[model samples]
Target: MKQVPPEYYQKLEELQAIDFVIVELTLYLDTHPKDQDAVQQYNQFVHHRKKLKKEFEKLFGPLTNFGYSYSDYPWNWKDAPWPWQV
Candidate 1:
């Protein structure tokens, strides 16, 4: 199996963290929609997630369609042994 690039792993890790933040903020936003602090934090998490997603796509491939890539890159999401496959 090919090793994942360090940059790709780093970006993935960052993205995962951002994902959690987004989830948490989502819950917070549900009841605290008027809270400026939560809204600001949620927006910042979105920015970080977007940046990490771009970095991941650039280093590896597209994980989604939200401004990740312009060209039709190889879709490896399904052609895998899953993350733990050897």
Candidate 2:
């Protein structure tokens, strides 16, 4: 497996943490829809996740097989190292 920079894993860990918070907040909101504070936090996390995902994809290729992360020149997803491989 090819070596990746430490920052790559750092970003991935940050994204994962944000995703975990979002999921937990979503579940909470399902039961407490009136919690405005939680709703605001959810939105903030969502935006943050999008920004992180964009940055990650730009440097490390698509995290998923589908979506806007696809590349045209050499099909980065095919050539880039997978998470486990790193």
Candidate 3:
């Protein structure tokens, strides 16, 4: 297993936190559809998540296998070290 930079791990951590928040907010919104404040917050987080994901993809590689984050050169997604391996 190869080592990844600290910044890469930090970004993944941030993205994971964002994803957790999104899921929690989704569950809350499902039960309380009339909560405008929660809905606004959810939308804001969604936007933030997208921005972070793009930055992550640009710096590291695609988080998913079939997204638009595919690289043109050496296919970093497949070649980069997996999280568990590091």
Candidate 4:
């Protein structure tokens, strides 16, 4: 199996954290969509997720082009090693 670099793992961990925040916010926002506090928190999660995803892509490869990496960047997400590969 291919080995993932320490930097990759670091970014992966951050991505996971952001994902968890997103999930939590999703549940919270379901009943509080109009709550400014929830909305701000949700926006913060999205912003952090984008940063983490960009770091992940730069260290490894893009997971999604939505805001991570540009299509012209070779789009190697499918070929990159998984987080737990080695």
The model with the greatest TM-score is 2
Backbone Cα, N, C clashes tallied per candidate: 0, 0, 0, 0
lDDT of 4 by residue, 29-86 (tens): 8988888988898998899887777666666765654663554345566677656563
Winner of 3 and 4 under TM-score = 3
lDDT of each: 0.69, 0.86, 0.83, 0.74
lDDT (Cα, tens digit) per residue for candidate 3, span 1-86: 55679999999999889999999999999999999999999999999999998888777667766564667576566766655655
Better of 2 and 3 by TM-score: 2
lDDT of 2 at 3: 76
Please, what is the TM-score per model? 0.72, 0.88, 0.85, 0.75
Worst 10 residues of 4 by lDDT: 64-73
Q: Sort the candidates on TM-score, descending order.
A: 2, 3, 4, 1
The reply for model 2, stretches above 4 Å from the true place, is none
Q: Model 1, range 24-82, lDDT digits (tens) per residue?
A: 99998999899999999999989877776766655565575555454343555553222
Weakest 10 consecutive residues of candidate 1 by summed lDDT:
77-86
Best of the two (2, 4) by lDDT: 2
What are the runs in model 4 whose C-alpha is more than 4 Å off? 64-78, 84-86
Q: Model 3 Cα displacement at 73 (Å)?
A: 3.5
lDDT of 4: 0.74
- Answer with 1 or 4, whichever has the higher TM-score: 4
